[model samples]
Target: MKQLFYFGLAQAKACIFPIIIFLTLAVTKIIDIPFLHRYDLILLVCIITQMLMLALKLETMDELKVIGVFHLIGLALEIYKVHMGSWSYPEEAFTKFLGVPLYSGFMYASVASYMCQAWRRLDLKLVKWPPTWIVMFLSAAIYFNFYTHHFILDFRWLLKLLTIILFYHTFVYFTVRKRTYAKPLSLSFILIGFFIWVAENIATFLGAWSYPNQQRQWEIVHFGKVSSWLLLVIVSFLIVAMLKHLKQTKGNLH
Candidate 1:
């Protein structure tokens, strides 16, 4: 029972930023602010949330660096996806670049923040992790497929197979309270992907960004997006794993 409480608390802490952003979005819709746009308000809220997390020691400097890396990565992807007409930020804001709001990166950073916090709070570790080079290659390929799919054949299924082959034998061990539990690494990716897909639906409902199909009215995001989120989860997991030197025990299954 105590373990469940701690686990829930940790999850809540991980979601603090996302929850705040969601609430801010909901509030902005009802309250008309002449000076501050919704995007600008979101940017401010994210920045303040980040600062508060640091001030309260909820996030460490090393974790902050990881979040920073995700910020740049997510922003680059946003710019490309927007250019490719995959999705779009329709709102105007001073912090936007090429129609991508700066706060959009925080959405990605929040995932890293959750992973880092969960790693620490849950005392998580990887076993039988794959080589860093292979993981890096898979990450790059997964990212590339997001763009190359428009110009060439989509190899996402191939990449997905590679991901499974690389990490199917791996496991993640995490503690809740004094007890420890383990899960297959690939399963963890799928679970997180599902949750992120749900969150994406909520985000779109709140007008964070819109798919081409959603411009007319809000609709449930396609279930197919869960696969994309699964790939992205692997990318985010690899980045966090590399930072923690998890690849050192590549073949140590025990």
Candidate 2:
């Protein structure tokens, strides 16, 4: 227990800069600034910060491993999506720091940080049924995201589909192999993914973020406005669930 606490403290020390960068961006309205103006520079800064933190080796090796996997997954997906034109950022956000997407690595780091907290607090159990759920949820998510804004479709979809399948299998293999999480966490990711698609679709339909060139007509779904919020809640709960379990376990150990 002491080891875990100390490790966390060390990680925090290592991550101070990246955390500060994110906070500064969030609070300073820099992130919200026009993508054409400063998005690229900001993303470049992010890439640098993450690289530095990763090289520091301040966190647990296990956490880094999971995060590396997530980073690769995010990288692959981002490239595939960009090629497909499913979604894209403005010119300023563009940066191929490592021959792939820049934002993905940042996302990977965040995911790793979140999962590390759970890993410390919980030893997950792997169950067979979760794979089935993963597949189903992914299918629903793809459909939802595509049906919404046509971000994922056409020739690229074939590749995207394959990529999603591969991602799911990889997750299954690692989560099951390491027993880092149980069915609940799997369900959480799947559900959240689906909700994101649905919410994104709703946003497109309502003209929240338009794809002017696509000229795609949205088939009206329901209020749809809440879909994104629903996703956020679910994903947040999943992380919390794992952390809550870990906290309880830590208390018992003490």
lDDT scores of the candidates, listed in order = 0.89, 0.46
Candidate whose TM-score is highest? 1
Among residues 3 or more apart in sequence or in different chains, the pairs in candidate 1 whose N, CA or C atoms overlap within 3 Å are none
lDDT (C-alpha) at residue 246 in model 1 = 45
TM-score, each model?
A: 0.94, 0.41
Candidate 2 has its poorest 10 consecutive residues by lDDT at 169-178
The number of residue pairs in model 2 that clash at the backbone is 3
Off by over 4 Å in 2: 1-28, 31-37, 40-58, 97-101, 122-187, 190-254
What is the overall TM-score of model 1 with all chains considered together? Answer: 0.94
- Candidate 1 contains a number of clashing pairs equal to 0
- Candidate 1, residues 72-184, lDDT tens digits: the string is 99999999999989999998899999889999999999999999988888888898878889888888899888878989999989998998899989999998877898999
